[model samples]
Target: MAGRRRTKHRKLVDKIKEDQRVSSVPDEQNSAAADLPTELLERILSPLDLRNNIRAAAVCKSWQAVATSVRKSNRHPWLMICPKVGNSYDFYDPGQRETYSLDLPELKDSRICHAKDGWLLLSKARTRRIFFFSPYTLELIKLPKLQSVHEAIVFTAAPTSDNCIVFTVNHVNPMAVAVSTCRPGDDAWTTIIFENQLPFVSGICTKIVFSKGRFYCLSEPGWLGVYNTNNGIWAVLSVPPPKCTEYLPPDYWWKGKYMAEFNGDIFVVYTCGAVNPFVYKLDETKQVWVEMRSLGGMTFFANFLSSHVRVDLKGKMRDNVYFSKVLYYGKRCVTYSVDRDRYYPRKQLYDWGEEDPFQSVWIEPPEDA
Candidate 1:
C-alpha cells in the first residue's frame, strides 16, 4: 500500500508539471513574436502590401525597423499635389483614400520634372537650379544649374545609385533636338544636337521613358524616337502613331496622353472626356502599336510628370488606370477599368487639357514611408 501511494503521488506531480508547461506556451509564443529574428520578420512582412506593412510596423519597434529595411519593389504609387501658394504638398493614396500633407519648403518655387524610385527631379526657374528630392526622408541632392529648361526630363534610376542618369531633350529646330545627359555627381550636363532622320518634333509636351539602356521619347504628335545610351545612337522608330485621334475630342487631345514602361514593354494611355481611356502597347518586334483590351493584371497610375505600373493589386484596383485627378471634394480619385469599360463612381466630364500639368504628379513612396 505504501509503494502504491508513492507511485500515485509521482503520477499526480508529473501531471501538474505537464499542465503548467502547457499553460506557459501561450505567453512564450506571444513573447517570441516580439523578439523574432530580423531575417524571419522580413520574410514575413515583405510580401504584404504597403498599407498592411505600415500597420504591422506599429506593433513594435523591432517590426518598424524590419519594415523599413524591406524594399517593396511592386508597391503602388501615390499622387502628390504641389500647392501653388504654399510649401505644403498633399499626397493622395488611392488604396486607402487618404490624403497626407507634408510641409516641404525645399520645393518652394520648384517644378517637378520627373519622379521615379521615390525621388523627384525638380527644376527651380528662379534659380535655374536642378536637383533631386525625396519627400519621405526629406533628402536632397543638388545638380548643376541647367542653362535652358528642358521640359522633357527623365532619370534612369534613383539619384543615389551610380547607374542613375538624367536625360532631357528639347527641340532645337524642326529637324534636330538638343539632347542633354548628366549624372548625379557631374559638374555640368553634356549637350549634343541630334538630327532626326524623320519628322520627330520634341517640345515641352513630350513624354519620355528609359528602358534597357535606351531612352524612348514620344513626341507631342505621337511619333516615337529612340536613343541608344550605350552606343550614343539616336534614331526614330518606324512604328506608326496610335490611331486615337478619331476617338479623342479635338480640343484636348494632346494633353490627355500618358506613357509608361513596364518589363520592357511600352504602354500609352489616351483619355477622352466621359469615356473609357484607350490603352496601347508597343510591339517592338513588329514595330507597331497594339491596342490592349486587358492589362494582364497590371494597374497603371497616370500623371503628367510621370507614370507607373504595378502588379498584383487587390480588390477593385487591378487592371485599372488611375488618373491623377481627384474628384468629389478630394474623397475619391478618378479610376477607369478597361475590362468593365467604365469609370468608377460614374464618368468624369472634366477636360484633361484644362488641368495644370505640374500641379499634380504620381510619386513612388518608400516602403517605410
Candidate 2:
C-alpha cells in the first residue's frame, strides 16, 4: 500500500510541473512585440514626457528608435538644480510640469558657469579644473587650465563644434585687462593684452557676451568694450555719464552694469541700490548707447555676477527685466516689467532646493540632443 501511495504522489507532482511550463509559453511569445509597427510605436510614445521617453528607449531596439524619433520634436529647456545631499542634480521640465533627477557622480561639488548649447561649463570646487559637460548624455570634455578668471567668460559656439572658441578676461594691470582664447582641442590658450586707451582707472571686466560675431564686455564704472574676434581688435565704446538728478554721488552708477544681446542688438542694464533699472541699447551705426524707451519684445535676465541673457518671447515676456537679485539690495530674485515698472517676486522658480544659496541663470537646451 505504501509503494502505491508513493507512485501516485510522484505522478501528481509531475503533472503540476508540466502544466506550469505550458502556461508560460504564451507569455514568452507575447513579450517580443514583433508585430507592432514602428510608426504606431512612435505615435504611442509621443504623448509621454521626456523622462518617460528615455525609459521607453530601453525597452528594445525597435522601441529605442521610435522613442528617439519622438523626442526630437518635444524638447524644451529644463531648470537644473543641484541638491546638497548627494551626487546628483534635478532638472525641472516646465512643459511637463515635473522634476526629474539625474545621477551624475561627475558633477560632485562642481561650480557651474557659462551654459550654452545644452552644455554647462563646470569647475571642480577643490581643483579649479575647467570642463564642459552635457547633463542629458553625461558627456564630459576637459579643457586646459585657466587661473584668475575673475568675472567674465564666454564661448563662441557649442563646445563640440570645430570652430568653437572660448574666451575669458582678467585684470592684468591697474588699468589694463588681458583676454585669453582657446579652442576645444587646442594644447594651450592664447592670451591677448589690451592696454591702450583705457577708459576707466580700473578696467576690470564684469561680464562678457559674444554677439554679432564679436565679443562685447562691460567693465566696472560703466565702460563698454567690444572685441573683434576676426581681426583681434579691441575698442572701448564711449558711454555717456550716468544721468542723476538727485543728490546721490557719481559712484552710484559703478555697481550694477550688465550686457546682453537680443535680435542683433546689444543692451546694457544698470541698477543702483533699489531704484528703477536704467536700460541702454547700443546703436551700432551711431556708436552710442541709446536709452531704450521700451524693450519691445525682448526681456533681459541679469545676474550679480555680470552674466546676462536676452530672450525674445515675441510678445509674451516683452519689456521686462528679470534679475536674480531683488531690489533694495539682498539676494532675493524678482522680475520687473519695464512697461508696467512693477516688481514680481520669482520665488516659484526656486522649487528645487539648492545646496548653496539660490541663483538662477538662463541656458539654452542643446538642439542636437
Candidate 3:
C-alpha cells in the first residue's frame, strides 16, 4: 500500500511540473514579442486595417507610438449618415461594411456644407454662422457670420492649417455674384461683387472645386466660372459644357451634376434615372471637356455637397463610382463600375434626381478616429 501511495504522489507531482512548464512558454514568448524592435513592430502593425490598428495601439505605449506614426497612410473614406430627427449620427465603413454610431449634439440644427481633409464645414440657418468641425476630435472653429446666405461653400485645405481659405458664392443678381472669402482667424469676411461677363447665374445648385490656386464653379446651366485666388481674377470660362447633357432630360439635368478635382485635374459626373452615369475630364491644353471611358484605376465618391477621388483602390472598389445612397437592408452602398458599366450588387434603378443632396455625405475620417 505504501509503495502504491508513493507511486501516485510521484505521478501527480510530475503532471503539475509539466503543466507549469507549458504555461511558462507563452510568457517567455510574449516577453520576446514585446521586446521587438520599433521598426519590426511597425512592420507588423502597418498592414492592419484602421480598426485593428487602433485596437493594437491600446496594447501598450510602445505599440501606440508605432501605430500613430503609420496611421496616416492611405485609407478609404467613411460615409456619414446625418440624423433627420435625432442627435445620433451613423458612420459606415464601406470597406468592412460596419456601422458606428456617435452622439453629436453639436450637429443639431446644423447643415453640412462641405467635407474635406477629415473636416466638415457646417452652417446654422438661424444664426447664419459658418464653422469648421472635426468630428474625430470634437474641435470647433468658428467663423464670422455671413451677411447673406451662401449658395455654396468650400475650403481649400483643413481648417487647422494656416493656408486654409473659405470661399462662398451667392447670386446678387442674375448677372452678378457675391463672392465672400475668409481665413481661420479672420473676424469678418471680405465680400466682392463681380459682374459676370457672361450670363453665369449662381444658386444653390452650383458645384465648386478648388485646384491649382483657382476655384472652378459650375452653374446650373453648365457654365464654368473660374476664380483665381492668388491674382484675384474671376472670369467665366468660354469652354462649352460637356455634350452629355444632350441625352439627359432638362428637368433632371441640374440634379445629376457633380464636380470633383483629383491631382489638379477637374472631373464632372452626371447621373440620370436608371442610366449609366457620364464622366468628363477637362483638357487644360485643349480647353475642352473630354469624355472618359475609364477612370484609370481611380474611384470616385459622389455627394450632393462635395465629391472625392481615390486612386488604385482594391477589388471592385477600383474604377468605380460610389454614390451617397446606401441600401439599408443589405448594408451595402450603391456603386457604379466604370469598367463594367453597371451598378454593383445587381442592376439598380436609381433616380438620382429624387435624392436630397444634404441627406448624407462622404467624410474622410481622421487617422485617430
What C-alpha lDDT values do all the predictions have? 0.86, 0.64, 0.86
User: Candidate 1 residues 230-310, lDDT tens each?
Assistant: 999888888888887677656665778899999999999987676668899999999999999998789999888899888
Candidate 2 per-residue lDDT over residues 1-369, each given as its tens digit: 999999999999999999999998776654665458877887899897655777888877778888878773323344566566787666554334455667988877777767766777767656657888888778899988775553456676678998688877777665577778888987878887887475533333366778877887766655667788889987776754334313234654445556776556777776654456677777778766777768765667665333444432332344577654333333233566777755665323321112122243445554562
TM-score of each: 0.79, 0.65, 0.80
**Candidate ordering by TM-score (highest first):** 3, 1, 2
Q: Tell me the alpha-carbon RMSD of every candidate.
A: 9.0, 18.4, 12.3
For model 1 the local lDDT of residue 236 reads: 87
- Per-residue alpha-carbon lDDT of candidate 3 for residues 19-71, written as tens digits (9 for 90 to 100): 99999998787677678899999899988865577788886677888987887
User: Going through the candidates in order, what is the number of backbone clashes in each?
Assistant: 0, 0, 0
Error of 1 at 264 (Å): 0.8
Model 2 stretches astray by more than 4 angstroms: 1-79, 82-85, 90-100, 147-150, 200-205, 241-256, 304-315, 325-333, 345-358, 366-369
Clashing pairs in 2: none
Judge candidate 3 against the unseen true structure and give its global Cα lDDT, from 0 to 1. Answer: 0.86
